[model samples]
Target: MNQEFIDHIKALIKNKAQSQLKDELQKLHPADIAELLNDLSYTEAKDIYRLLDNEIAADVLVEMDEDIRKDFLELLPSATIAKRFIDHMDTDDAVDLMRDLDTEKQSEILSHIDDVEQAGNIVDLLKYDEHTAGGLMATEMVKVNENLSMPECLKEMRAQAEELDEIHYVYVVDDDDRLQGVFPLKKVITSPSVSKVKHVMKKDPISVKVDTPLDEVAQIIEKYDLVALPVVDSIGRLAGIITVDDVMDEIREQAEKDYQLASGLSQDVETDDNLFKQTKARLPWLLIGMIGGMGNSILIEGFESTLTTEMSYYIPLIGGTGGNVGTQSSALVVQGLANSSLDSKETVKQVSKEAVVALVNATIISMLVYIFNFFRFGPTAIITYSVSLSLFSVVMFASIFGTLVPMTLERLKIDPAIATGPFISITNDIVGMMFYMMLTRLLS
Candidate 1:
């Protein structure tokens, strides 16, 4: 699907040129147009979007990344964006787009949205925190009274068919509008006319509270394999449903955030972000690393006299091998943390695998380092055996710490993201240095 449409559109845009691109974009569905837009130059995309209907434009805008959407909004004048276009969007998307706009611009966009119901919906959706169920759910779910017979349920659902295009399940609610159960569309259509919705509905549907963390919600969704899940208020009244598509987006966003945090950048870092912002986000980490390196320099200075007196030919060789060993251990532990594949049940297995991998690499590299030094310096290289042993011990200990630190942090209610950044690097460096010094002393 990605290749077929994208290639065809590419030929149209690139071969036929800008005028043809604009004309071709008009013929595409909003989602398809969105895909095409993603591939185009920002100026070309803007021009093509102007040629399309506002309703189509709005749909594509919602589908776009926040960067592209913000840029598009900046280009379009308020008058061209119709009330129907804004009204057609889901409340969550509307709120997200609006939140990016300046207060005055947000008000201007809101003023253009004349539909009171849509306006109120966007307002209500904006009230919830972004990580919670209220922020994640779509307001487009189907609801019906519990008293309705299966025939009545079918009739009511059919009556509302025009308004329920995206409906996957129908909710059963009490007179007070509190959710009692949910009935999938298939069940309603297949059940006997005499059977009430109560007889067919799932009494306790999988749901998340409005304030539940996004990660926890994602975990529940994964654990249950739910195509869609309902969101409820503190009072247990159903508000909306979060779809699989939205959950997938949340997962990608979270993964990106983890990457950025691990690299010591802002969670919002993007290719389109300004240079100054990117630098500001990255500067702290570089500075911290520099300071940490300075500490390493100081430690080396303290050991300088010992090194000078020992006059070891194997120092360079040992240093190179130890660095490589420490790096390999750090990489494995980081991978294990990111995958969450290492848990208490498999802790022993993961540690053993890590140890074997680290040990093998350390031994091979250290043996080569010792061999080269022995040939070059004649018996002075015996010190390398001690250096190699120390490096092996450091890597083994570092791997264990790397695995346990995140686990312990999570248990203590700290975000595990902290373990990925300066924390891990600094801790590993300290441990690695200690290993080097201890080995040097024993060898001397």
Candidate 2:
């Protein structure tokens, strides 16, 4: 959004010039409107929102950041929210919005929704845990009975197409509504010479169960290069469909969350969040890093008698090098796990591979540091050999430690992202200090 346009809207809002503000809003996209809302105060947002038509309001609401949308939605009445926004959203989006509200608020909003089928679908979807395939799938889809004739299937498709805004794929189901196959759109138009839908449909389609984890669903879709995947019940009955767009949106959200974790935030947070919330999300890791710093100091104090003053000068180099090596190893492991390129079962293979890479990295780094120190201080000085050996030991140990932590976390069903950033850096800093001091003592 243009800064001039936003300032103009603000001025119009301040002046209470509703007519001109509405006209200008009409010229902007829903995403632009959403961005403007995020930048405005509650009263100003509400004023600008009132000028939008129900459909556009719904679109803007969806486009807004979840934090901004949740705060904005709370100020609206249940009936106003239901009629003006939820009614226009897809069932999946509706579920997402509803999840933000309390059960009582959700019930009140659902009661205000005019479409009984849409309301029922949202209710059924709410029964699912939010991180599963069922919660992400939409009840809206076109399906034909496997036993239907070509003409019958076409009629069914025409009738169903009337309800949906867009169609990704046509599904074929048995008498029990158990998913059987996918009926291609091209096959539908050409009216393939087959007698029944069963003969023409592509059987044994790729799919996931309703309770499948969101990660598994994303991987299956990406692996198959599918635009959409059918969701099935425990008994193999078709429940809903997951379109790739929805999956992509979820993947983006998860990526943001993981990025935040890697940056040391303990919880979900946004820039729009108030001071307390932002502090709460950030303080835990900062405190942990502080403790790790204290621990490193105590280690140095304990080894002070054995450590030379010159060795202290090289502590920063060793600690920083260790942290960098650890961070790189954990990041690669996390990325591999996310893309399914590295199997959790293959932890030994991954660690073994990382060790070989670390050996090469450790050798190169130690040699470079040794040569630098050799030129600065004579090769006979114990400090020269101590710092170089410490660098080599720290690099190898940090690399192996970083790789092991995330792999263990993955096997234990913990988010591997926590293994990055402060967690790895703090740990490596303390351990690297210990390595430098011990190697210095031995060489002395």
Candidate 3:
């Protein structure tokens, strides 16, 4: 949010000419207002919102947090709002808003909506789950027939330009409305006037179905460095296009989900989400960890009798090594999987590479510890070797667990990021503690 722009909006709201404020706000882009809306309080945002036309407000509203948006909707009289603003919104944006609305509110809004076509589009979009490609795509796209000449295509585009928002790609379709191919606008413009779209356009355009997952869509866009990707139906008919901007949102949403899941919370946990709801989301993981800890305790208590001698003092050494190695491996594996780069071949390679690196560090560190033990406590070579071996094993185990757990989660269709910190830490702590104590009994 730009502070200067926010200040300008604030000053405008303070002035007497509330009527003129809408015209001034229209000058700013919807993205700018969306940014500013996030920065403002609900009340302050409502004031700024009322000044804008319904279309602008609806666009900005879709970008806002769920709680604040609900509050803003209530602030306005129900009759003053119409479905046209929402009608102007893309299918994805409309679905998001509809999903957040209360059952009664949703029914009321839909009933009041005059445009049957737009309302039906929203309903169609709402059928898909939120994370799917159908839920992310906008139905507003420019499509032209492959048979159209340059002059005919230009005239059609000029007429349709007002209806479409994201116009980076002009899709070439057949009589059946099936996507034949697509090319850059530059190609369309530079081609000879007599060249048919079919002759000029590249066939076999890379495309995705409407039901594809958001992360997969993001991956395709990123991999191809696309400005826009066409969304198609199961039969490969053109559905819509998801612009680069929406892909950016999907990336941010996925990143936030990864962060939340890594901390053992649901993807919906946001700053605006209620405390009790957030607490409930995390409590399950903490309880599971506690259960694991207690189970670990029972096992460790069995070794309480054997920790009576020289080895008791060295227990911490093994635990520390295991914890560090496990954490390092988990981080690498988690990142690899999250970015869709981790596979069995890569995992094997990564595990091998990481194992070598960890072993080298562990060997050097254990040698240093052994040297210190010799000078500080006059330990025998056997005792030093035992400790070194225990530490090395712990390090190796930690690295293996860290690399494998995330990969396993990915195989199960769970996010690999969730395996990074808390899950890694808990497993490492339990394994490290148990292994160190178990090894100590043998070494002693």
Which clashing pairs does model 3 show? none
Sorted by lDDT, highest first, which candidate order results? Answer: 2, 3, 1
TM-score of each: 0.81, 0.96, 0.87
Residue lDDT tens for model 1, 372-442: 65766576554546656765666566656656666566557665665666656665675566667667766
Q: Provide the clashing-pair count of each candidate structure.
A: 0, 0, 0
Off by over 4 Å in 2: 14-19, 192-194
Cα error of candidate 3 at position 284, Å: 3.1
Comparison by lDDT, 2 against 3, better one: 2
Candidate 3 local lDDT, 1-444, one digit each (tens): 668878777777777457666776778788777777877777667777667766777777777767766777765544444543575677777777778767677777777778888778877777777788888788887888999988788777778788866577888999999999985678657999888888888899989998898878988989999988898999989988888888788789778777777777754676656889888878878887788678767767888875555665775666556666776787778777656777744667777887888788778877887787787667764456666666777777788788888877777877778777567767777776676666666766
| Total colliding residue pairs, candidate 2 | 0
lDDT of 2: 0.91
Q: Largest TM-score belongs to which candidate?
A: 2
Q: Considering TM-score, which of the candidate structures 1 and 3 is the better prediction for this target?
A: 3
Worst lDDT run of 10 residues, candidate 3, spans 76-85
Question: What's model 3's lDDT at 290?
Answer: 88
